[model samples]
Target chain A: MSILAVGTVAFDSIETPFGTAPRVLGGSASYLTLAARYFCPDVRLVGVVGRDFPDDYVQRFRDSGIDLRGLETDESGDTFHWKGRYHYDLNERDTLDTQLNVLVDFEPTLPEDYRSSQIVCLGNLDPAVQRHVLDQVDDPEYVLCDTMNYWIEHTPDSLRETLQRVDCLVINDSEARELANEPNLVQAADIIRDMGPETLIIKKGEHGALLFNGDTVFSAPAYPLEAIEDPTGAGDTFAGGLAGHLAQVGRYGADDLRRGIIYGSAMASFVVERFGPERLYHLNRELIVERARAFRELAAIPKLAPLQAA
Target chain B: MSILAVGTVAFDSIETPFGTAPRVLGGSASYLTLAARYFCPDVRLVGVVGRDFPDDYVQRFRDSGIDLRGLETDESGDTFHWKGRYHYDLNERDTLDTQLNVLVDFEPTLPEDYRSSQIVCLGNLDPAVQRHVLDQVDDPEYVLCDTMNYWIEHTPDSLRETLQRVDCLVINDSEARELANEPNLVQAADIIRDMGPETLIIKKGEHGALLFNGDTVFSAPAYPLEAIEDPTGAGDTFAGGLAGHLAQVGRYGADDLRRGIIYGSAMASFVVERFGPERLYHLNRELIVERARAFRELAAIPKLAPLQAA
Candidate 1:
């Protein structure tokens, strides 16, 4: 099965309490493509970038079996750029700058070959653009969408409309509560489920992620890391791993979804270990699996006697 | 096997985003006794109260098989009282008032019969009180102590001295970081293990708890609840269940510690579902076992084929 990932493919400068790096090739598509390439070799990448973005970085995707036919080159403008710094508590960060060069006016167009992909990943983007990508897909099996607080605050109706077309929704804990207007996360998942998607995964960063499917719910903690070099692209990498693993399995069950989360978490662990996509870009299958095992072990509490009923 | 819980037995008025409860029976010892009473029938309570404290409230402990012989009544002063309000986020609260009546000159004296208890739970209290309680234990097999930032910030040396005497230390994530002076939690656990305790459990409130032993680390997420009436005694209840389970099994190993965390999480689940200790007071073994099962189920992620190691 093939996967289609649509989002920004640009540059980022990020700093944390640990350290800082400047002007790195980092964006949703860049991180997603590298992570998803580990599970599925044939991943279709669709995003606009400026001419100045390194050819070596673009060539790296091609080398990793990611089809770059949908990668648009805007010769007139520099690539989209973002700079941010994390606080002592890595869970939150402050955006230092944002330069939406080519990204300001670019319209996404899926290649004919990518139109038949089975799994679609709509990374954080305007609701209108996300819908347009879905409109081009010819009956994809699973369409997972990731959005931020920006879209939720500005385009509630457009976001809700896009939610109706996706099978999975990946959002952070606060955004979930804000979108559903419910303080309780469980209630928020319920409200979001009612709005559309059959599954909702609430990413709580360091706390981990929660999965909700009807009354059934599952939670897995993130593989706790010691030093978080950079947090940029972690979420998109997570979504990529989830979609990639599910596409490989062809069926998404409780167990499969749980494993998918582990995969997503493992991918994210590497994403934060280095600035931009440095660590994830060089991540091999062996390391990914090792991290996955570490997560399983870290969260592996021994089973005690079962609880008696109320 | 019996458990000894040493801490405060006071009153509190709590207000949350959901509702408010005025002048409820609360305190570390009160919550610990109720929580420990679930696993081991014998829980020796050692604390001080005042003349205004009612009889029925004390009777609740007597009915739960708690030895209240060490509970001193100060006729000259009023009971210690606290008032606090939680924001929409239950994890944080603003302190409204703190009236240390009997607690001002409080001196805990372990009953003659209490010194021989096999399990010791040193609930959050003044470092001096915690140290006094430690002196009373007669070669206890398991001594677990809980502390907050109050002591960590004020009496660093006394806290360190008390920490060295305990086998397991239970503290919040921030306190753990603060105590070790390490920014990274993983590294903080390492420094803490070097300080004294054989194992460390970092409580992250709703995020969950992390247990770090010599080379093994286990994590358990807080069971997702629909409503959190009051978080006043959740941590004490958690410690109670942990020490209580250890006393019941008469064993404390890496595996047992892992199971202990799960049991603790289960007991805490009951604490927040109602006001003060009302929910936990009526808890039975069957009910606890059911919640323990739910914790196991909630943490169950489908096992994946081991990732290929690099």
Candidate 2:
């Protein structure tokens, strides 16, 4: 049950009310692969990094057990670098700069060994690039794709084309609304399902997340945090956790999808406790198990005595 | 166990994106009593209504199996009327008008039998009035009080005095922050707990609710609806449902509190389906049980297999 994460492996300069993280190791593929490697060992990453991409970061990925055969390095450009400032609430952010140097003209060609990955996680990128990665796949049993409002708005047709091939789509509340052109999330999920992926995960940051699969909808509550240091890679980490769980289980039943959402929610909760994705790298199996248990306790409803009126 | 609800019982003119419900039956006591009667048979209401109040609405409360012995009629003034307009999203609303006529100088003289009620639900009202009603209660085993930002800002001392006597305090997200002066809801709950009530429920309308009692927190998911006709009395309905559940169980253990939260959340879900408390009035026990089951399913996380790395 190998997971192939295809997207940018770049840098982020994040500024939050708490402090600043300068040029931290980031990008969707970076966080997704790191998170996916916990439950899933055979994680292959396909992305273009610039020549300026640190050797230490490459080593970090290798040390973390992520396959780098598909991690291409551009000879003449810097890595994709994004600079964003989070507001006081951290719910909204303002992108100050975006340097898509290497990613601008990037084209990924999955390695021969990576072509047969069971699960392909298409991270936020050009819709054409996502489909290009999918095109190289020999046989993908499950395809989980992530996209932002930028792609949904700028290249909707291409995005829809890519979405049609994916088994699941992971997007935030606002992105789902914008993409579906519907404010009501349930109806939005229904509309989106008609266009593409049967499964849709609407990530509602601190509120929680909702999984719409077939005729069922499963909700996972956000772990109540006392403070959020940074929220840079929470969404990617969530996707990673979910894909990893699914890959490990090697099935996508109703129960499996629900548990996967919980695991994803737990991972996303841990990532936001610190800046960037530092907290995720330090996590182990026991900690993850306990976090998942904590989530169960948080949303657990016990048996109740029958009402007197009843 | 008898439950007494004390608050404004009046009319509301609500304008949502869908349509308007002009001068419909509303107010905290109106919705609270209607919702609470579903769980606890001996539900008592203590509120003042104007002479202009329709007798049919009064009979409607009686027909719903609510005790109206403490419902006082004031001859000189009109009933409290609130006019509000909900935005397109139904999350934010603008208060168009507030006519605090009968509620301005309302003083309740609770009946002898109602004073001995085991559970007391103090809905959103002037802190002085909430405390006044509590003062007349003979021996309340469990006291659950709700408040708004206006009272927190306008009458801090009185609210704190009322809080000290109440066993549980239920308020929405913004009011909790305003009362505790903390932005983070978990921290806000802690600060508010120290101020008064040991148990606190922070209702996040669309997201869900958090129950903070003792050393535990129980999170409940909001029921995902295709449409929300109005959100006028959702919080009060939530409180009523919770108090009613607790009263029916006749105990307040950790498990009982958790289940109470689920029941309360289910009740709140139905109230918003239509304007004011109209939906609650037509609800039967079977529908309520099903809705609670739906909540359990909505937030249910299945028993996942151990991680592959483990």
Candidate 3:
């Protein structure tokens, strides 16, 4: 099983309360494929970069053993660049600028080899592009898709159309509320599953993520981090790790999905420790497993005994 | 083991997005002892009420087998009255009015029999009053204390003094931050424990509670509810249920604390289902147990197997 991740591969200028990272290696597909490579080796990347794309970063992807057959070099312009600033609490961020340079005109055409991938990760992108990628794929066993508030507001119909094609949809709490137009999360989950996606993950950042699968809701514990330098691609990293884990295990059963969310949380926890994807690029299996164990411990309790009435 | 709970027994007028419950039975001790009585029969209440205090409410406590020997009828004025309104999300509330009435000058006096009670729950009150109650207790084994932003701001010195005597502290996330003067909750727990209680439970309302016991932190799951009429006595009810569970088990170990938090959460979830303490007053052992089980399932993941390094 392999993952086909399609999204932006671009540069980000991020500013948080801690400091700033100017022109750092970032983007949805960059973080997704990089984090996914740790769990699944056959992770394929389909994204458009530009002439200004760093060679060292490209070498970094190859070093991680990511198949970049569909990584297009749109020499017409520089890569998609995003600038954002995070508040003091790090729970909210304000996008300062977005220059969708090459991303604006580039049409995604998946390489022939990537079409047969078993797992497909539709990173945060235009819903139409997401549909286009899905159209090219043969028959994905599991399709994990993500969308942001941008597409949810601007292109509701296209987003709803894409939602119907995916097995799982990963989004944050606000996006879930906004898309469903429901204040209560449990009700929102119900309304969202009606639109499509048998599985929905509402990421709450520090509050952890909620996985609404079928009629069951699993509350994955958030790793308590003391310092978060930059939260540039934590959500995408979370999706990547989840998709990668499912790919490696070759199963997406109830318990398997739960474990995948934990792995995703573990990956997200690591990515936020430093700027860009520095921590993701350095993590080993030992560290990942350890962090996952810590997460399990965070929410563990002995099986409860029924209390007798007084 | 019996619980000696010291707090208010007053009237509450609540306004929510759903509807209004005007001047209903409320106060910390009313909610606490009502929830606690399900777990332990030997519960004592120590609060002052006035002439206008309803006889039906007094009868309600009597029917539940709560020892009211420590409950004083001051008769100087009416009971403390609080008027508040909840936001649409039911997360934050603004205090519309607070009429201390007889409660302004009332002094709590624990009965001789109550002084020997095994457990003590100091509900949200004046820090000095909390300390005064502590002084009357005869070497209680485990003391659980709750406070709010009002005391944390107005009586920091008194609150700090009271903190040193309690075995566990139960407060919400924001109060914990304000009390510790630290934004990060994990770090806040460390700082708070240094000030007093060895165990700290930080309630996040809809997001659930976090129990920091020694080195282990347990993340308790929130029960999702479609409707929340009022959230006035939720924190007090939580503390009561926890203390009552600890008393019933005759233990306050790590697992005990973990289970106590679950039971506390179950009680809290029920209280908010109706106006004021209406739901809390009507809950039985079976309903409490069922909700606790639901909470467990919310955060339950299969005990994970260590994954092999890829």
**Model 1 spans > 4 angstroms off:** A306-310, B306-310
Tens digits of per-residue lDDT for model 3, B40-126: 999999999989988898998998889999999987799999999988777889999999998899778777777788898998889
Docking category of candidate 2: medium
Give the chain B TM-score achieved by candidate 3: 0.97
| Per-residue lDDT value at A13 in model 2 | 97
After the best TM-score superposition of candidate 3, give how far the Cα of residue B227 lies from its true spot, in angstroms: 2.9
DockQ of 3: 0.66
Residue-wise C-alpha lDDT for candidate 1, range A1-310, written one tens digit per residue = 8889998887888888878888888888888888888888788898999978888988788877888999999999999999998888777889999999999887887788877989999988888999999899898999899898999999999999999998899999999999999888877888899989999999988878998865777888887687777788888889888888887788877788889998998899888888888776577887888888888788876767643221
Clashes of 2: 0
Task: Predict model 1's lDDT versus the native.
Answer: 0.86
Where does the lowest 10-residue lDDT sum fall in candidate 3 chain B? B301-310
- What ranking of all candidate models by DockQ puts the best one first? 3, 2, 1
**Number of backbone collisions per candidate, in order?**
4, 0, 0
- Tens digit of lDDT per residue, candidate 2, span B1-310? 8999999998999999989989999999988889888888899999998988998998899889899999999999899999999998889999999999989998788888777889999989998898889889888999999989899999999888989998999989889989988777889899999987989989999998999988888888988898888988988998888888888889988888888888888898898998878898799888888888888888888776666562
Give the docking tier of candidate 3: medium
lDDT per residue (tens digit) for residues B49-118 in model 1: 9999999998888888788998999999999899999988787899999999999888877888887888
> iRMS of each prediction in angstroms?
3.7, 1.7, 1.4
A245: Cα error in model 3, Å: 1.0
Screening candidate 2 with a backbone cut-off below 3 angstroms (N, C-alpha, C), the clashing residue pairs are: none
